[model samples]
Target chain A: MKPAIKRIIFIVILVGLWELGSRLGLWTELILPSPTSVFTALYHGFADKTLIWDLIASFRRLAIGLTLALIIGTSIGILIAKSKTADDTIGSMLLALQSVPSIVWLPLAIMWFGLNDKAVIFVVILGGTFVMALNIRTGIKNVSPLYIRAAQTMGSKGIDLFIRVIFPASIPYVVTGSRLAWAFAWRALMAGELLSTGPGLGYTLSYASDFGNMSLVIGVIIIIGIIGSIVDQLIFQRIEKSVANRWGL
Target chain B: MFISINQLNKQFLDKNDQPTTVLKDIELDIEKGEFVSILGPSGCGKSTLLSIVAGLTSATNGEILVEDKKITKPGKDRGMVFQEAALFPWINVIENVMFPLKKEMSKQEATAQAKKYLQMVQLSNYLEHYPHELSGGMQQRVSIARALAMDPEILLMDEPFGALDEQTRTRLHGQLEEIWIKTKKTVLFVTHSISESIKLSDRIIVMGTRPGTILTDIKVDIPRPRREHKEDMLELEEHVMSYLKKEIDKVVSEELNHETSH
Candidate 1:
């Protein structure tokens, strides 16, 4: 068998075994729900207005946080890239902070902003912005001197130079950074929802687990994974591949 | 008044707080509609000299005037073609050609102008092709077209065809000669290729390294659109080689010695 086919069949067999084992009474249906039961749970989630509200709440937080990160990070990146003083001051700090996980900020975030969605948004921004800044700065700095020289020769200077040459040339790297940031932010949001327990997918998971409805918990976990993957594959991955992979810049 | 470079000097600071001269007290005058080539070996600072003249870098001590205006900085009067094509990958061929003009003209005007220059380069069919999509020769043609579209007072090229294959380079030589005759633009082209210097340049400035300076300024009296490898071309090639071979050998052996010592 082809390697890809073999891998697919192996995964199918594993999932099938899990389903069959639960059905055969090796584990209770409450703890390890059948795939059918989880699919039903997913259906029930969409059948109400509550799930919509949860999604809106989560999305709104993600939107606000990510947007702020984009603006601030991009500005910081440009500064660091353009100035040696800025790099000396902030570059090391950024490196240190990026190494420190966003989850590590949760306790402090709770202390500062409380358990509201603001705290979650704050965490997301903290998770996302540094990655974007570092990548943008790196991309800008790595730009070929030849390109800049050519642009100068063509009478491109100042904003014209940046807009025409620097930004477009650095876009592929920016997209890569953004994809990485989105993953970090999304995972952070999920963890935030799980811990904070206000509303959203994470809340739903905790609520199901609290109620000892393990099947619903399993269902929520699958839903989160699917949503994350879909967003990555459909949106960020597509953009990254289009800009970075195809060009090989 | 097309271009004048007076007492051009450039210095670089070495690792030990010592200043090293790259180009020395050079004086050059380029009249309107002249084609000049600077010839030198790798470390001879010919590229540095060209870059300084083009206003890509500041001359440590000198003045460059394009059309009687002191060129302390880069301007539209000078259009430069890099050693690499250096076309922005995101933009298509036409867009790359149109870039210098887009800020001045309307989209329609820029498009027309871009199309005109692309046509000159025989790249009208590849207008929508991205930089990576085009062959190296095609990309360099686009680069030339991009510079030509600017309609600058002078064209500055830094070994622009160095990376190309010999056949493609020869083809480009012919195309470039045709374009030069058609446009009559002042050109200051830099190259290490002796045949290329003889073929393209009206005047050749041979340079020497180790505090780089002009060694000789030999005029090629050949007519435009001359055959590249004919007996006369070979004789001129020999003349250039006679000057450059010793310098090239010295630089190569010095480099090898340095590497071995390291």
Candidate 2:
């Protein structure tokens, strides 16, 4: 059978099993809501426009945070790659900071920016920046010296060399960095949103859980997982593959 | 002399931080439109000499002058082709050729110049093909086209065909010879292959290892389309090999000694 068809069948079987267990009273409806009820909650949430607002708000924060992270991360990455002092100082600091989970910064971010979008965005930027910076640094550093010498002999120097040779050669790394940053930022967003009062997937998930609306909680969790996979597999993975193919990395 | 190296010296600190001389008292000169090859075995610093002349490496002492002007850094007047093609993998054939011309000409003019050289190298059909898509010989051809597109006063090539199979190397020799004849560009070619130096050069400067110095500077008077002078080419190849044999022996013994010592 076709792989797509096989996957569909597998999903159907899993959902059928879950529905059967729910009907058989294997557990309370509050603990293990049937897939139908979860889908219904999803439908109602979208119909009420709450899910739409939540998605918009979540995406807006993500876009802003990721953009800022990429710009700042790339700049710092270049600095670390090029300068010995920066590599020894800020580079080491970044390596250390990358180990700290993004959610661990929630208390500090909340204290600094209050329980607002700014706090969540701050956490998201932190989540993405260190990994992006490290990847970019590695990317630039790993550019073959042969290419640099070739460019130098061709009358390329300074900014021209970086833009034409180094940057393009390091594109495979940048693509990888962006993919990792997206994942990190996505996780950070969810964690930060849990404490946030604003309209967001995490906020709604928490609200549903607190109100014992197990179906709504399950629906929101499914939405988060689907969005995460869709963005990664559809967008970032495609970009990475094309870059590797073209660059022969 | 169009290009001259006067008492050029290069020293590198070895693993123990002791300065080891790589090239010592390397003096040579080349006339305009002359094809000169620096022939040596590995560790002979022939590539270093070429790199210094290309202004990609600094000489520890003395200097290289192009058209009577001392050169300290890489310039548009001197173009270098490394052993590896070193074409930008991200760019297509035409774009790689146009790279050096970006600051010198408009986009359309640069494209025209790039296309012209790509045609000269017989890669006009592969203009949009990325470097990764091309074979090794084709990649080297693209690099040669890229270097030629700049219209430099001197062309510096460091064993540009060294990595290729023998058949491909022989084929490229013909193409390179044709290109040289058509352009009459002053060429400084470096190679380990004795026949390659004899096959393509107006003069071959055979180098000795261990503080690399010129062993002999032999001029090839063999007629153009040198294939017609196979006997003459073989005679000179043997002559060049005689000068390199001692150096090659020295390198071999040094390796053997190091291994046994370990």
Candidate 3:
């Protein structure tokens, strides 16, 4: 059978089993809501435009945070890559900071920015920046020495050399960095949104749980997983593959 | 002399921080539009000499002068082709050729100029092909085209065909010879292959290892196309080989000594 067909059949069997268990009163609806009720809750949430608002709010924060992270991270990466003093000092600091989970900074971020979108975005930026910086640093450092020498002999120097040779050569690393940053930022966003009083997927999931609406909570969880996979597999993975093919990395 | 080297010396600090001489008192001169080859064994520092001339490496003592101007660093007037081609993997064939020209001319002009040189190296059809997509020989050709496109006063090639297979190397020799004849750029070619130096150069400077210095500088009186004069080519090749054989033997004995000591 085709892989897609097989996957559909597998999903059907799992959903059928869940529905059968629910009908047989094998478990409380609060603990294990049937797939149908979850889907119905998803439909109602979308119909009332709550899910739409939540998605927009989450994506907006993600866009702003990710953009800021990339710009700042790339600059820091280049600085640490080029300067010995910076590499010894700032590079070591970034390495230390990278190991700390993004959620660990939530208390500090909330204290600084209050319970708002700014707090969530702050956490998101922190989540993405260190990894991006490290990846960009590695990317620049790993560029072939031959290419630099070749460029030098061709009259390239300073900023011009960086832009023309070093930056372009390090693109594979940059792509990888962005992909990682996106995943990190996404996770941070959810964690940050949980504490913030906002219209977001994380906020709604928490609200549903608080009200004991198990169907809504399950539906939101499914939506989050689906969106995460779709963005990573469909967008970032495709970009990475094309870059590898083009650059022969 | 169009290009002159005066008492060039280079020393590198070994792992023990002990100074080790790589090149010593390497005095040489080349006239305008002359094809000169520096022939040596693997560790002879011939590439070092070429790098110094290209201004990619600094000489510990003395200096190199092009048109009586001291060369402190790499410049557009001198183009270098590395052993591995070193074409940027991110760029296509035409872009690689146009890279050096970007500072010198407008985009349209650079494109046209790049096209002209790419044609000279017979890679016009592969203009859009990325460096990774091309064969080793083809990549080297793109590098040569890139160097030629810059229209430098001197071309310094460091064993440009050293990595290629025998058949590909022979084919490229023909192509390189034709390009040299057509452009007449003052060429400083470095190679380990004795016949390659003899085939392509107007003069051959044979170098010896262990504090690398010029062993001999022989003028090739053989006329172009050199393949027609096989006997003369063989005679010159044998003469070059004999000079390098002693150096090779010395290296082998040294290696054996080191191994036994270990």
Q: Please give, for residues B73-135, the per-residue lDDT of candidate 1 as tens digits.
A: 887877888888988888888988998998799999999999999999899899988888888
Best by DockQ: 2
Over B1-262, each residue of candidate 3 has an lDDT whose tens digit, in order, gives 7998999999999999999999999999999999999998888999999998888889899999999999999998999999999999888899999999998799999999999999998899999999889999999999999999999989999999999999999999999999888888999999988889888999999999998999999999999998899999999888888888999999999999999999
Which 10 successive residues of model 2 chain B have the least lDDT summed? B48-57
lDDT of each: 0.86, 0.93, 0.93
Model 2, A163-215: lDDT tens per residue? Answer: 99999899999999999999999999999998887699999999999999999
| Candidates, ranked, DockQ | 2, 3, 1
Cα lDDT tens digits, model 2, B118-165, are 999899999999898999999999999999999998899999998999
For model 3 the local lDDT of residue B112 reads 100
Worst 10 residues of 3 chain B by lDDT: B235-244
Question: For every candidate structure, what is the RMSD over all alpha carbons to the true structure, in angstroms?
Answer: 2.3, 1.5, 1.6
Off by over 4 Å in 2: A1-6
lDDT of 3 by residue, A20-100 (tens): 999999998989899989999999999999999999999999999999999999999999999989999999999899999
lDDT of 1 at A189: 86
lDDT of 1 by residue, A108-178 (tens): 89899888888888888988899999999998998888888888888788998898899878888788888
RMSD of 3: 1.6
- List candidate 3 stretches off by more than 4 Å: A1-10
How accurate is chain B of model 3, given as a TM-score from 0 to 1?
0.98
Cα shift from native, residue B22, model 3 (Å): 0.5
